[model samples]
Target: MKLLSVNVSKPKTIAYDGKSVTSGIFKESVAGRVMVRKLNLEGDGQADLTVHGGVDKAVYVYDLASYHYWERELGRADLAYGQFGENLTVEGLPDDQVHIGDVFRIGEALLEVSQPRVPCFKLEIKMEMPGFSRQFLASGRLGFYFRVLEEGMVGAGDTIERVKPGPEQMSVRETAHLLYFDYDNLDRLHRALRIPALSQGWRDAFAELIGTSEGAPKKPRAAARAWQGFRTFVVDKKVPESRDITSFYIIPEDRVPLPVYLPGQYLTFKLAIPGWPRPVIRTYSLSDGPCHEGYYRVTIKREPPPVDPSIASGSHYFHDQVEPGARLSVAAPRGDFYLDPAEETPVVLLSGGVGLTPMISMLNAIVHVGKTRPVWFVHGTRNGLHHAMCKHMRQLAAENDNVRVHICYSRPRPDDIKGLDYDSSGHVSVKLLKRLLPNREMDFFLCGPPPFMKSLFQDLRAWGVPEGRIRYELFGPASLLTEGTRIPLRKPKPASGAADFEVVFLKSGVTARWDPDYDNLLDFAEDQGIFPEFDCRSGICQTCMHELLEGEVDYVVEPLDPPYPGRVLLCCARPRTDLVIDV
Candidate 1:
């Protein structure tokens, strides 16, 4: 595959315009190509380009990683720095021809097509050249997202080489089309759904669409009953350390079929705190590998004062108020943070304080899967007393000869120095990390508080760890990561005067006026005494879902479960037009 036109536009807003090419580096991956041409807008008075070719290509429009190609091509060294709608603007390839696990070499870098992108309203704004959005939607050439297998420099004029063809017989395009456009085509969708390459997001999307279709196979009413209300569970477990952090073994009381989750996933618990009018929800990552029937484990750290009041209160409530016998309402597991067992490279798991939960899950999974790769586990904590699951980790290390554990204490107490099996007494500095894991080729997974995670990320980059191999998880909301990061977080400014928007809940028949400051659609509805079912309230849960009968909305965080066409998570979603929602 040959590179065609390398176009870029730096709009006042990160939103794209067909005019001047943006001044930034652009990175492109080899995938199915789509036809590109310029179009004229009636009132915007600007020429916008439209990408065509490929049926059911809705995937490409909303994918952030795929959009990196366009950003890199614009001369932006930081591919994740800029905001472009989609990445590569191509000409020949289509979705039906490409398959998952397919490896392609673009310039010197290697990428594997992991999954199809899911479209969103951001594309409509990016392609505001009259009917550009509509035409692209009709054409259905949504591009795909790729996982970087090998990292190297890429540029325009480089040929894309197909290194490995995917094993699946069906292309992502055929699956997307059958699921989205032709709901009546159940046979094809079900058949494609059986493919392991199909993502859980796509599967959930298809399930929603097909389940709502006319004359679709009706699942037993009992199956739907399982998900109707929140399930409560009471869990009690022991923590190895004497610190405030504790581990709990949780199992659903209703015996409901639990959704299988990945190692680095988290579950949001909704607690009914006394004196609080509404339920309080917080997210905590699972601390164990996947099990068939055993209880899932979670480790929680009690936060002391002087920190943010909200977090401190929440942490205190979980530790002090919530008891071992008390039942807690929980949402299904959700998150994109996961380790790929297919990755055979050396692994480095980094954690600080309570952030060790997910890393424990990953290490346990690696060991469970019997992966023989060299494993380096580095943990940082205030002291041995505060170290959250030190005993469990020590036991695993003792059992597995391939695993190596390194502990760094920021503040070592008199007892900590005598009792702990720590390798170092200082904080996790670059000097210690380099000495422990001399090779920089390992995949690095870091999880911690914002400060700790950020510092480690900077240190790893300074140590020359490739960007592709360095993965991280935000402990709180996506906003936390957006703050002071390379990516710009431009909160939409309210209009000069209060711009009133009429939002009609089509299903509930509740009409409300939305204020610009109360931009969150879900929050606006809740304020109006119209409660939408929500769990995380952070956009991770797909519960506060509503179909968009009319108008537009912007999603602040990428949903773990792909939204059904014209549907959105009301929590972090903001309306862009006078709206109608099926609440």
Candidate 2:
């Protein structure tokens, strides 16, 4: 295969569909040679490092030949090299020919084929075509990803010569087929797993398949072991954090040691209220450090619906109805939004309102772990009455000279003293941040309301903070960290000719017509008087997961973590075809 063009671009945030997303997909064809590095091209960068641009997926390559296929398929001649967001647009290489572990020399650099490129929603934005990602995957034209073996300069017209073939000799086509279609073939999967250069993600999937075939592993990270429906827990203590916020310390009835959860992880509680017909499942961040054994602390803000009294009744129930000694059904802690214990960089913890719950957990962890990394705890609330954990935070800061606290009350009371009770009196704006922050280079962790998060995200970007350095936790629906701007809604495609198509709850013995108004099957099921077990309706907890006995479903919003094969998270999925779910 011959390199036709070398494309590179720094990620740029764009306003699309009503969200702000940083995408590095708009690669431009460079005129001259570009230096390829271990992580990425010298001129290129990934928007999110968690999923993209690692040692396993340093460079993305697409076949220029496929552009011809897409040109004919789309009936458009506007297609160009690097349009598929590929760093290296080659002439001859296709998805079928490349193998995982195959090493090739292009220009002065040596690259190893690692894995198939998994398409995300960014493809739809780049192509300006709704549902383009599904089409791209279905087309089987997924380009291969490469890891840089040697850093060197590469340019257009460079010839790619294979220096070594893969150990398994499994073609990229076969791997994709095994992954998506022929996943049941244990023999083929075993062979594919032998490839040393195969990506961790793909390797994990293969291991899962092998494990499933030969009795699934007893302890898989994807599966919850301690969770069995929801066990009863006693609210041991109720301590008021603020006037409106309270901390509930809950202990298991068995009084066993609780599972160790990372700092910033949350516990999902299933609350059975007096008035509500169905039990409410709401997630609250574990406020206290894990060092405190036998019990978990959740700081909850008594949220009252301002415009309508119908919302957040769970918070209302927790504040008014629930008290010490109350039996509450609680699920095991689960969340991806956690402070990395391994991260050694200077930390900046920012919060607004009751968002300080997870930050306090992280801070306590930093102290407990004996980490001396410089920490800045900055918080914003209305006043002393609204602020929670003030004494605890101050005491922690006093104990650790490395930890600095800055509290900003948006509306301070007459009794609140400056530099004593509070540091400042204003909203947590960028101006205040600039003054308080020693530097803009620390690892920033932010949590708060939509408006607060939106402003801070934009401000951080403006301050040239790398997206990878900024981590955040959203309270609900994964909508707080808006990924992209809202594009015009596309017209719904006509339904296939099957008027009887409807979701069938196999065990529930209920069938319901699919409604577009309901964002997911969980909502639709609730509307049908069938409340399937659920927590973190955002799809993080995987509690609502059930067997997809038959038919197909599509995710309106993709889960934070993918569920195991044949299982669907009802919270985020909707019936695409008539679905038979073991609920």
My TM-score estimates for the predictions, one after another, are 0.49, 0.50
Q: Residue 256's C-alpha lDDT in candidate 1?
A: 29
Runs of candidate 1 with Cα error greater than 4 angstroms are: 1-229, 236-240, 306-312, 417-420, 475-537, 540-550, 554-583
TM-score: model 2 vs. ground truth: 0.50
Report lDDT (CA) for all predictions. Answer: 0.61, 0.80
Q: For all candidates, what are the clash counts?
A: 23, 9
Predicted structure with the largest lDDT when compared to the true one: 2
Query: Which candidate should be chosen as best, given TM-score against the real structure?
Result: 2
TM-score of 1: 0.49
Residue 60 CA displacement from its true place in model 1, Å: 46
lDDT of 2 by residue, 57-126 (tens): 9999999778988999999898877899999999878888888899999999999999988776677788
Q: What range of 10 consecutive residues in model 1 has the weakest lDDT sum?
A: 38-47
Please give me the total number of clashing residue pairs in predicted model 2.
Answer: 9
